[model samples]
Target: MASISSLGVGSGLDAESIVTKLMAVEKLPLTRLTTRTAGYNAKISAYGAISSALATLKTAANAFYSTKTNLLTSTVSDATVASATSGTSASSGTYALEISQLAKAHSLSSRVAGASETMGTGSLAISNGSNSFSVTIDSTNNTLAGIRDAINASSTNTSVRANILTDTSGARLVLTSKETGASNTISIAVTDNDGNNTDAYNVLSNTNPGLSQLSFTAGGNNLTQVQAAQNAQVKLDNVDLSFSSNTVVDAIPGVTLKLTKENVGTPATVTIARDSTGIKKVADDFVKAYNDLHSTIVKNTAANPSTTLSTSTDAASTASALTGDSTARSIDRQMREALRTVPSGVTGALTQLADAGISIDSSGVMSVDATKFQKAVDTNFSGLQSMMDGYGKAVNTLVTTLTDTNGVISARTTGLKDSIKLLDNQKEMLNNRLTSIEKRYRARFSSLDTMISGMQTTSTFLTQQIAKM
Candidate 1:
């Protein structure tokens, strides 16, 4: 074989150019395969967009049909006094609420005289009526600030929070219960074992005294109970109820009541009703999502202007990559049919989307007639829900068929991938064949160049020999 670098050197013929031209012709089939691979890849991407749009539509439809979408609103005449939250289990009703007192946690402040004083080098034990935890008071945590930090850092000290308050006199230790219930009343006791120093131990003991030391009259310590640990007191419709916490759940079936202030003897009316605003928003979202999906389908399936036979040519030449595709056509057709047909599970006057103020037009896009929808919601709320639920099921089914693992989109994607792989194999085979052809062409052209050089040499020899004759 002749070296590629010197193939045309012998005959001065442009053999490299000739071989390149031949190889270009030979690779025609590979070019076609490459083009086909690109087309398949583009189709896969188009399907991805289609599937994504359908997924959005499916999510909206599912939300519209959910039973939990039946929203309820709680209205308190005076939110300043109290507020409430309502769920699906809550029933529409009015209740007269009179809050006698708000639940409070126990708070105690030590005497202001020795406010900056540190006490006790032993363990401070706290009891929450039933449970007890101890905070160690060594030299490292012997000061008022250290003891406060030790109490806060103790894993078992979950029932109470120790704080230090500073004023004109000095800083005093303040202790408060973590819970509001009466059973969570904080009991403080101190025991000193640190022989190094008794100053911290003595100070803590003087401030807290003991669990039975409820009065601040002993040791000049002003241990005053700022607030008592008490349960919330409320009279609902003149019926009394008590709770350990201000936020009460199941106080009225599915309603949660939060007492902000005490309004004794004065009644605040609380009304629970169906939340029309929330329900309407769900419907509006459904319409918007459907329109978005419809728009995607229209844009992708619009025919080129040259191919259009109808009067409509809003989307002219430069048709989408998905134009004239059967899958695109199927999606458009099925979506329209699903939106148009009344749900099989729904009955009565509010059976169709249009009955609930949602209408689909020739463009296959949905719009909400807010006035009519509100009327339908007010007139036959349950019936409207049933219609939406049933339609949502149908839309979900369509999306599942198209986007599922064994669905059309997956199958099409797999097919495109296989085609690309096959094209790759064809490209490899063509490349191998071109390699052999290039080798043969270089050798044959080298022989021709050698023959032409020899022929010119022989002609020059014959002319010299004839001139000598």
Candidate 2:
């Protein structure tokens, strides 16, 4: 009938301590569940490490499939005159390139005119060789600044740019051709609504016998030429060629030339060659990545007996998280098989990876012999390429299977997580049962303590009665 807190006071017994000991015994299942959850978490972490290593290996494997794997490098002898770039289609060759002329943009400036002065209501027709467009100059946009804005806003005004140049003399309207070819010439004509007062158009046009908007000759209103339009002149291997743009790609096959400055006499040598260094680096990276993956597998799956008398001791093993795991073992075995087995569809003495100078040691580490690889590549480049392609394909396929959405690694991690969730649920249920058991133990102990207290009180009263008699 007594409460748990008052049980010890009634009979001088440690009832709460006894209930704690009973609850400890009842919570054994919770400890097991906790240990299992920890194991599952460790396995998930181990799978994560494997996934990261596989991702690195996949990247290295993908490099072999790239067209740029046998990429070419280009160099220009005189960088001051020009620069060069090569693509996959480029072959190893040399060319003597001379830049006779650099492409120039056509620039023209109007005669001195007040910056704020209105040009009057009219339309100005502008042409760039093949295409012609008009800009309407209304009262709102008749000023120099307004006309500049209007020209920029015209959708059809693609070949020319307009700017107002302010000097000590006054402000002038400058028009420049957007393109750099001689064919891209600038021409302009004015149509005035106020025929007599065409000051805006006159200030910017040449008033010669045949008045033109682009000419900067005498009889013009002091209109000056800033820079004339010129086509880029180049001599490739002594043959003259002209280009509309300084950036020429068609001058040489699979090569793009960027002309920097005009060198009438000086020639810049351009060369394109196979990039052996790049190819070798890719091969080196593959070997390193392969070795890294192999090492990780060995470290995680191998057993250690140094820690104790038992050869199956887990404490001394490097892969505590993944020790004795079947999935880990399977991954290691598959990777080893991929490395050892030669790809199918090849018939030659150089069919295996060892023929290409890629060798694996007893410790599961891979290395490439540079001299042997170079000799193999020089003799049979196609064979080497095919071998790497086959090997990369096999590795890529295996990696994808293990790392994909429904992959073994992913599924295993998910399973472990689910197991941990189950363990958590089990722990919760065990804790609930233990809580109930503790409450029952306390209730029973409290009742026993109350009964003992009552019996002792009865014994004490009887002894007092005997003494009085």
Best by TM-score: 2
Off by over 4 Å in 1: 1-17, 67-84, 91-100, 110-125, 129-150, 164-171, 189-224, 233-242, 250-253, 257-277, 295-348, 359-364, 369-371, 393-408, 446-469
Candidate 2 C-alpha error for residue 178, in Å = 4.8
Report every candidate's CA lDDT.
0.76, 0.76
C-alpha TM-scores of all predictions: 0.73, 0.80
Distance from true location, Cα of 258 in model 2, Å: 2.6
Error of 2 at 126 (Å): 4.8
- Please write out the lDDT profile of model 2 over residues 105-153, one tens digit for every residue: 8888876666666555667777886778888877787767787888888
Q: Which 10 consecutive residues of model 1 have the lowest summed lDDT?
A: 209-218
Clashes of each: 9, 0
